[model samples]
Target: MKLLEVKNLIKHFPVKNHKGQVVHAVDDVSFHINEGETLGLVGESGCGKSTCARTIIRIYDPTGGEIIFDGQNLATLSQRELKPIRKNMQMIFQDPYTSLNGRMTVRDIIAEPLIAHKIGNSQKERHEMVAQMLKQVGLNTEHGTRYAHEFSGGQRQRIGIARALILKPKLVICDEPISALDVSIQAQIINLLTEFQQKEKLTYLFIAHDLSVVEYISDHVGVMYLGKLVELSESKELYKNPLHPYTQGLLASIPALDIHAGKITDKAEMSGDLPSPISLPSGCRFCGRCPYAKKICAEAEPPMKEAAPGHMVACYLYS
Candidate 1:
C-alpha cells in the first residue's frame, strides 16, 4: 500500500539580486513510498535530494506538484486542514545540532510536537510519552532533563529520533540521519532505525548523498541528478546494474580496494561543473556532462521509461 505519493514536484528559489532568475532546486520529480517500506533517495550534493524531501513534508511549499499522503492531497489543504495531517508526517532533519532547540530541555523538545498537536492535555502524560520514546531510541529517561547541547552527536540524534517517532508518524523523512555521526556510531543508528521499523512498521523516505548508506536501509532506491530522477529500481538491482549514464558514473565513483576489479575500466565520468540551476541545459539537464550525449539528447529531454523489469531510466538511449 502506498503511504505517500509525490507527482511532478517542483521547487525553485529566486536568485538574490537576479531578476526573473531562479534556482531550480527540484523539477518534475515523482516517487511513492509504500507502507512499511523505505525508499532511499540518493544523489550528489546540490542534486536537490533535500529539496525533494522538504517539499514532500511541506517544510518548503512546492512551486508546483501533488503530494498525496494517505489518500489526501496535501497541496490543496489549508493550514488549518493540514494541522491533523502534519501529525502523520514528520521529518528527522539532517543536522541534529541545529534541528534541536538549545534553550529547551530534552523533554520539552521531544514533547513540543505532541503539545502542538494537542495529543496530550496534561504535562504528566506528555512526560511519560517522552520518557518512553527516549528509551525506545536507546536514550536513558534521565537524559530528558539535560539540554540538547549537553549530549554528543550520536546522543543528540537519538533525541531527534525520539521526537520524530513520538507521535508514531506513518512517514518519516530521514534526511541524512547518520551522515554527521562517527563511522562506528553510524551502524548503531542504522540498526536502531531498522529495528524500530520492524517493530512498528514505519515507512521512511531516506535521503542521503551516500549511495552505500542508502543501499543499506532502502527497499527501493531512486537516483536524482539536477532535480530529476534519472534511475530507480529495487535497491540491489539499482546498485548492481545501474542504467542511466549519470547512475553509472555515480556507481563508478565508489572506491574500490583491488585495482584489478572487473568494474568499468573506461568509466564514464561527468565533466564540467554542474550547470547553474537558474539556467539549466537546453534539453536533458545532464547532457552537457554525459559522455553518451547525442544531438537528440541536447535537443529534447527524455521521459522516464522502463529499461528492464522493475528498473526505470530516464535517457534517450533507453527511449
Candidate 2:
C-alpha cells in the first residue's frame, strides 16, 4: 500500500511586488512512497526538492494539487484538523543547528513533540520515553540534560532523529538530514536511520542533492530538474542504466572508483544557467542544457514515458 501519494503538486511563493509576481518553486510534480519503502527525491540545489517536501507536509500550503496520505487528502485539512495527522508524519530537517533550539536541552527538545501530541499524560512517562529514545539513537540519558549547543554536529542530528521518531511516525521526511555533518559522521547517521527503519518498519521520503548518497539509501529514486521530475526508476536500475540525458549528466558527474570500467563513451555535460522558474521555457525545462534537444523539444513538453519496465523518463529524445 502507498503511504503517501502526491499528484501534480504545485507551490508558488509570491515575490515582493505590487503586481504580485510569484516564484514557481515546485510545479506539477507527482510521485508516491509505498509503506515501508524509502523513495529518494534527488535534485540539484534550487531545483524544488526541498520545496516539494515542505509543500507535501503543508509547511508551505500548496498552491494547487493533491497530497494524499494514507488514502486521505492532506491539502483539504485545516490546521486544527491536521494536528493529529501530523503525529503520524514527521520531518528531520537539513541543518541541525538551525532546526534545533539552542536554549532547550536535548530532553526538552525530544519531549516537546510528545508533549504537544499528548502521547503521554504524566511527566514521568515522558521522561522515560525520552530516555529510551536517547539510548535508541546511541545517546545516554545523561546527554539528554545537555543543551543542543553542547553536542557535536552528529550528536545534535541524533537528537533531531530521536525527536522525529519518538512518536513512531509512519512516514518520515528526511530533508538532507546528513548534509551539514562531517563526512566521517555521515555513515554513522545513515546507519542509525537504517537500523531504526528496520526496527520500526518506517517509510521515508529522503531528499538530497547528492545522488551517490541517495543511491545508497533509497529503494527507488526520482530525479528533479527545474520543478519537474525528469527521471525515476528503481535504485539499481537507475544507477546502472539512466535513460534521460539529465540523469546521464548527473551520473557522469559522480566520481567513480574505477576510472576505466563501465564508462559510457558519450558523457553528457550540462551547462548554461538554469532558466528562471518564474518564466519557465515553453517546452522541456531541460532543453537549454540537454545535448540531444531537438526542435520539438523547444516547442512541446514531453510527457513522462516508460523506457523499460518500471523505468520512466521525460524527454522528446525518447519519443
Candidate 3:
C-alpha cells in the first residue's frame, strides 16, 4: 500500500498588490511514495520544492487538494486533531545551523520531539533514549550535553538527524538536508541517512536541487517546474530517458566527463527568465523556457499523461 498520496495539491500565498493576488507556489501537484521508498523532488530554487515539502508535513495549510498519509487526509486535520499524526511525520530542514536551537543543549533538542509526542514515560527515560540515539547517529552522549553552537556543520546536522529520527517517524521530509554542507560532509550525511532508512523502514520525500544527488539517493524522481510536477519516473529511467524538455535540460546541466578527453560536455542552455509565479503564462508553466514549446502549448494547459508505464509527464509534446 502507498504510505503517502498527494492529489492535486495546491499551495498559494496571498499577496496584496493593486488587486489581491496569489503567489502560485505549488499548483495541482500529485504523486505518491510507497512504504519504505524514497521519492526525490528536484527543481531550481523557488520552483516550489520546499513549499511542497512544507505543505505535505502540514507546516503550511494546503490551498487545495488532498494530502493523504497513512489513509488520513492531513490537509483537513486541525492542529488539535493532527497532534498524534505529527509524530509519524517529521522534517529535516535545509540549514543545519539555523534549524538547531543554539540556546538549547543538544540533548534537549533531541528530546524535544519525544516530549512533544509524549513518548517514553519520564525525563530520565527520554534522556536515556537520547543517549542511545546520539550513539546511533555517530554522536556521543557527552556531546549531547554541549550546546549546538559548539559542534561543526556536520555534527550539528547529525544532531538534527538524531532529533528527527528520535521518534522513529515512518515518513520524513528532507528539505535539501545536505545542501549547506561541505562536499565531504555531504557524503557522510547521505550514508547516515541511508543507514537509518534501512534500519527503520522509513519512507522519504527528499527535496533537492542537485540532480546527481537525487539520482543517487532516490528510487523515483519527480521534476517540478513553477510549482507543478512536470515529469516523474523511476530514478534510473528518468536520468537515462527524460521525456519533458525541462527534465532534459536539468539532466543536461550535469557535468558529464568526456572519456576520451577527460573534460566536461556542453550543458543544455535555457533562454529567458522564469516568469513571475503570480502572473504565470497560460497553458504550460514551462512554455516560456521550453525549446520545443508550440503555439498550442501557450494556448491551454496540458493534462499529465503517461508516456510509458509508470512514467508520467505534463507537456503538450507528449500529448
Candidate 4:
C-alpha cells in the first residue's frame, strides 16, 4: 500500500527583489513511500531535501502539486482539516540540540504531542505515557524530570524520538535525524529507529546527506540534484549499480577503507559548484557540472524514465 504519494511536487519561494522570479526550491519531484517501508531521500545541501519534507507535511504551502497521504490530498486540506491527519504523522528533526525545547523539562517536551492531540484522559495518564515512551527510546523515566540541556546529544535525540512516537504515528519523517550526533552514537540511534519501526509497523521518509546511513536505513533510495530527483532505486540495487551520473558521484564520494592496498579508489569526481536555484540552466540543472554533458544535454531536458527493473533515472545518457 502506498502510504504517501507526492506527485509533481513544486515548491517555490519568491525572489526578494525580483518581481516575478522565484527560487525553484523543489520542482516536479515525485516519489512514494509504501506502508512499513522506508524511502530515503539523499541530496547535497540546498538541494531542497528538507523543503520537500516540509511541504509534504504542510509546513509550507506548496506552489503546485499533489501531496496524497493515506489516500487523502493533504495539499488541499485546510489547517483545521489537517488536525486529525497531523496526529497520524510526525517528524524527528535533524538537530537534536535545536529541535528540543531548552526551557521545558523533558517530560513536558515529550508530552506536548499527547497534549495537543488529547490522547490522555488526565495529567497523570499523560505522564505515564511519557514515561513509557522514554523507556522505549532508550532513556530512563528519571531523566524525564531534567531539561533537554542536561542530556548529551544522543540522549536529546532520544527525547525527540520519544516525542515523535508518543502519538504512535503510522508515518514518521526523519529529517537527517542522526547528522549532528557523535559518530559513535550514530549507529545506536539508527538501531533504535530500526527497532521502533519493526515494532510499530511504521513508514518512514528519511532524508540524509550520508549515503551509507541512508542505505542502512532505507528500503528504497531517491537521489536529488538541484531540487529534482535524478535517480531512484532499491537501496541494494542503487549501491551496486547507480544509473545516474549524480548518483554515481554521490556513491563515489563515500569514504571507503582499503586495508590490503592502503588506499581508496573509484571516486567519481566532478568539477564546478552548484548553480543558484534562481538562475537555473535552461535545459538540465546538472548540465553545468556533469562531466559527460553534450550539446543535446544543454538544449533539452531529459524526463525521468525507467532504466532497469524498478530503477528510475533522469539523464540524457539513458534517454
lDDT per residue for candidate 4 within 1-319, as digits (tens), equals 9999999999999998889999999999999999999999999999999999999989999989999999999998899999999999999999999999899999999999999888999999999999999989888999989999999999999999999999999999999999999989999999999999999999999999998899999999999999899999999999888878888777777777654642224546667778999989989888988888889889888899999999999998987
lDDT of 1 at 138: 89
> What tens-digit string does per-residue lDDT give for candidate 3 at 30-133?
99999999999999899999999999999899999999999999999998999899889999989999999999999999999999988899999999999999
lDDT digits (tens) for residues 1-319 of candidate 2 = 9999999898998877635678889988888999999999998889999999998899999999999999899987888989999999999999999999999989999999999998898999999999999999999999989999999999999999999999999999999999999989999999999999999999999999788889999999999999999898999999888889988888888777886775743568677777898878999999888899899999989998998899988987777
Poorly placed runs, candidate 1 (over 4 Å):
258-266
lDDT of 2 at 40: 95
Candidate 4 collision pairs: none
lDDT of each: 0.89, 0.91, 0.92, 0.92
- Tell me the deviation in Å of residue 256 in model 1: 1.8
| Candidate 4 TM-score versus the reference | 0.97
In order of appearance, the predictions have TM-scores of: 0.96, 0.97, 0.96, 0.97
Better of 1 and 2 by lDDT: 2
The digit string of per-residue lDDT tens for model 1 on 106-161 reads: 99999999999898879999999999999899888999899999999999988999
How many residue pairs collide in each prediction?
A: 0, 0, 0, 0
Colliding residue pairs in candidate 3: none
Error of 2 at 308 (Å): 1.2
